[model samples]
Target: PETVTAFQLQKQGSEGSSGERALGQQEGYRVDESGKVYLPFIGEVQAAGKTVMELRQEISMKLIAFFPDATVQVRFLNFRVTLIGEVARPNAYIIPNEQLNILEAIGMAGDFTPYARRNSVMVMRERNHQREFVRVNTQDTTLFKSPVFYLKPNDIVYVEPLKAKQYATQGDFLSRYSPIFFPLVTLATFVLGLSVR
Candidate 1:
């Protein structure tokens, strides 16, 4: 999945006379275009369609063939989210951690602009090959409990612009109507000049 770009795999260390030193041989793996992760002994393992738990289990099973007491942990790395429209800085940001909320995501984008509609923020997400859209109201206290409060990897957050922005940019009456009436005014001026001559 595009959302899952990289992950880390850790193998638990065995207890010794001085006790275990936490994890052993922690390695970072990147998912290739074909959605496969290449490990030392396991070769290429398909990681695209599998969940975190499934991938961890598969890796553990494979590692056990080499080490009788293999304990494996898999976690996503390089979490990212995109923000667009009516924000101070609209761009894709790489989050350092997995847990991210709407407020934090907005903050990462440098907050909303003055013309932003805080009550009409939208989130676009893709899961299991299906796209889902959700609206969030940053002005409401109840937003804390919303399902979209916590953003997922590759999720897009869009802040809508207020009608005031549109009205302000519409320009004055003359500029707006000149395009339609300028031709008629020119034609009439030519006709009047001919009549007077």
Candidate 2:
């Protein structure tokens, strides 16, 4: 409110414009052959392997040196995560924001089916330029603390199946072994009706 002067007012929205061109971003842009981006102020930030937050902070620091008294906003203009393996819809979803989590991803895939193994969910993430694997068990309530609970940009979630699903499916092939064939409750009801008759 104190910036009544025209000079101070100009700084309100100016993003430290140093005549740099706005960069085009994609939904998790593929690393260029050089594995980098020619950012406005930060130059070629090591983006291919860094997380969004890491890149943001690095750019913020670099911008501070140049802007001095300005504010900068860094964001992954486009990002996504892939959910595959047994999910109803196994595809890459553009994560418009960072609020997405494991449950949210599963929800996006139409939730889990009876065949899905809630305990065998897996996530693939990159850390320090190295790929890492993590497991998630939706049946377990403590999954909130599991490292894989959060879906990062480009994370892949896989929902496996339990053996019981296959075994139960097998019984359907044989009439005598059919899981729906033997209902003792039906026999008990029949006998009770006979007595009533």
Give the TM-score of each candidate.
0.63, 0.57
| Candidate whose TM-score is highest | 1
For 1-197, candidate 2 gives per-residue lDDT tens digits of 33323113111211115321122322322346565766544567677667668877776788787667655444554356777777787766665465678998888877887788888899999776799998878888989998777777678788887787778767656656545555766787899999999
Which residue pairs does candidate 1 place in steric collision?
none
Worst 10 residues of 2 by lDDT: 7-16
Clashes of each: 0, 0
Q: What is the lDDT of candidate 2?
A: 0.67
User: Residue 158 of model 1: what lDDT?
Assistant: 96
Which tens-of-lDDT digit does each residue in 1-197 have in candidate 1? 43133333444233224332222233367788788989776789999888778999999988887767767767656466888999998877656454789998898788999999999999999987799999989999989998899998789999999999888777666588889889999999999999999
User: What's model 1's TM-score?
Assistant: 0.63
